[model samples]
Target: FDVTFVNKDNLPEYVWANSWGVSTRLMGALIMSHSDDNGLVLPPHLAPIQVVIVPIYKNAEQLKQISSHIEPILLQLKEMGISVKYDDADNRRPGFKFADYELKGVPVRLVVGARDIEKGTVEIMRRDTLEKSEAPLEGIAGHVKALLEEIQTHIYRKALAHRQEMTRTVDTYDEFKKEIEKGGFILAHWDGTTETELKIKEDTKATLRCIPLDGDTTPGVCMVTGRPSKQRVIFARNY
Candidate 1:
């Protein structure tokens, strides 16, 4: 799977890489990072349905009329490069559909009912913030596009902040152990020996995740085995 696309002469001396396939364990990380008591808050880029359009009506004739009116709007949104879904399932009620879409992490939901049709507007609900607003039927495509971009950027910033807050730097074994118990990445010095690495794993259950592409070259002593060290390595109990 590691196909080299570059010329042999242009390759670097050490091309370090690791491939870890996604498994059910990734779901655990997702839930830990994004879920709350109410439900999961999905990143906008990962949501299957960017916007769910649910037309509410009492009778079949009313449902048909509402659907016909919303068809062109849906098509216009699609043409503008927005992912949209129409939920017209008869089995579930509107409340049930709302709950289901929220669980699946749809970024936005638009409810277009008989009343909304008369008012020339739609009820919009944001999954991440749970904020509801009324939007005019005409400019929904552009508004939704902007809202989705904002949600995507917000999720990335939140996740990056969590990663930064979890990272810890320790110069002593006692501090390393204490921080590792709190469950986060630990940056520490190592002697660059497989034997010491194995011993650390045997004792703390933490392994070197990466040596980092760019690190300080200042010489130091290893924290574990008291051997001469060159650079620090990031260690963690990985997912």
Candidate 2:
């Protein structure tokens, strides 16, 4: 039976049947993909606050000077259409603010203190690698903009590499079972039948994740039944 729609002229029309919905599962996927032991490592493009400025100072006078120096850089970033936050509140300590913004997934963090002002430099940290470096105050805004773009690309490539490392190709049911226990994507052949799919699930608790629309389409034999198969499909244990 074909699933489709009816036209205004009372004629049956062909349309692609699709399923769509919004859920918090997307948030879960984001956290699982980029988060680390420290906290969330959000890509800059998706971050609400792509950059956060944390002022490190001992006294109000020191903060006043630091804020004076940081204000221009903050304005420049905002002018360039980059979302940024200047955290100079007196209640929270600078260390606490650093931890909070890091946990919240701000991609770039700039720390400016009395010494930095004297040296005409700011300490910058990127959440993706948690690497810190010093940069002169001159043209800091433009540097941060470029850093955000770099962070986004670096995290994406890192996640891609991780996925590739975790994925496995197996030609035997015994190898499939062992790989499934390790928990990642498994590419294996399955005879195109509902009974075979159900049998595999019953035995291993792994299901066909998807039949990729693109990729290798070479013929193979089902690992379980030794029957001819069209192509390999992604199989994995759902969480």
Candidate 3:
């Protein structure tokens, strides 16, 4: 139920509220917002395993050496509170490991080949854009922390942009009915009456998702009833 305050005596008559937090919708939202044909494109902060390191070498001796070289690097990452995995399973090739982690949505991947160990570097790959770059292991702790933050911001911006693009601004009821069919957020003026809100939903199955915190404030008339409205509210056919 939408209630303004914890106690009935503490709220203004017009204020509205609801229980807002994580729910079953979170999984659906994440999948719809970010996942692609390649697989899930998880944001770094939410990934259970943020970094996966795959070791590549031509021989058992080099594999042993690479392991020794990367042990310190893994420890450094762990000390920085970065979740890391050294994928040392011998049954799978490095290429297979890469594809596996990419499918599993590890936000960051490091390929530590024999050459990289000799050169004191690692090949880092970002899952979001599938971009790879070589980075020296020196001061890797700080560099990785920054990269994770960048990935987080990048994904968030991309999702917000998608939402904005999906939204429609309508000034007429006919346009509302037609736009609602496409199924995204709708920005429209309403008559500030629950009767008009319910009627719109009955006719088009669209509901007022919210009067956006930063919604349009220009004086206008409701799209349905033409009654004077002070601002535009967000309407949507949400799941």
Candidate 4:
């Protein structure tokens, strides 16, 4: 059913949008595009935290004491503009939390239990590469901030490289299909007609994602119809 609401005593313009119902599918695409057999490799900037602090304890008293100590540290980190999460949940094991956080792409994790407290340090784990280091409890906020920035930059560069490696230009339908199967954006000539667009979609399942913002205005023949074309349009099977 379509419901209408009056705004300022006038009808508003109706905008149409398409959906693939692929929110879960998009996550799958990200995993396929970015992950290895080990697990997900999330882009650092998109990661929930550059740092996560997990406190381990054996009993209620120990948990309370550890939490009390960590609160000041968490506050300091927050004051310094660092995003931090302290996992004190009793429902899950430390190993499970570690694995789950890594899968979710948290950049850094710090484990502070009774043992680490005795040593006046915390176990800091890097999620991107499973790297671990010991960081002193004092002055940890600044150190974490710097490390998170580094991870963010590193992930962006890696994603850019992956995109570059996957993209290609094609001149023929046969070549276009071959590259598209490998999964990436394709640049090719089009006849600029709805009929040609429909035919291409019928054959390749590809659609015009957009007439790109900066397409070159050059004379060419349409790959499908052999019709004169002013420029090429971008085509892709979008999410």
Candidate achieving the largest lDDT: 2
Candidate 3 per-residue lDDT, tens place, 168-224, comes to: 899999999999999889999999999999999899988999887787899899999
Where does candidate 2 have its weakest 10-residue lDDT segment?
Answer: 16-25
- The CA lDDT at 20 in model 4 is 71
lDDT per residue as tens, model 2, 190-217 = 9989998898889999999889889568
TM-score of each: 0.81, 0.88, 0.84, 0.72
- Runs in model 1 with CA error above 4 Å? 1-40, 214-219
The TM-score that candidate 1 achieves is 0.81
Which of 1 and 2 is the better model by lDDT?
Answer: 2
Determine the C-alpha RMSD for candidate 3 after optimal superposition of all C-alphas: 6.3
Ranking by lDDT: 2, 3, 1, 4
- Report the alpha-carbon TM-score of model 2 versus the true structure: 0.88
Model 4: runs farther than 4 Å from truth? 1-50, 59-65, 215-219
> Which sections of candidate 3 miss by over 4 Å?
1-18
In model 4, pairs of residues that clash are none
Cα lDDT of all candidates, in order?
0.84, 0.91, 0.88, 0.77
State each model's C-alpha RMSD to the native.
6.2, 4.7, 6.3, 4.6
Tens digit per residue, CA lDDT, model 1, 1-239? 45444557886454445555355667667767775565878776776678899989899998999999889988988897778999998899999999988888888899999999899899999887789999998888888889999888877788889888988888888788888888989989999999989988888899998888786567787888778889888999965
Clashes of each: 0, 0, 0, 0
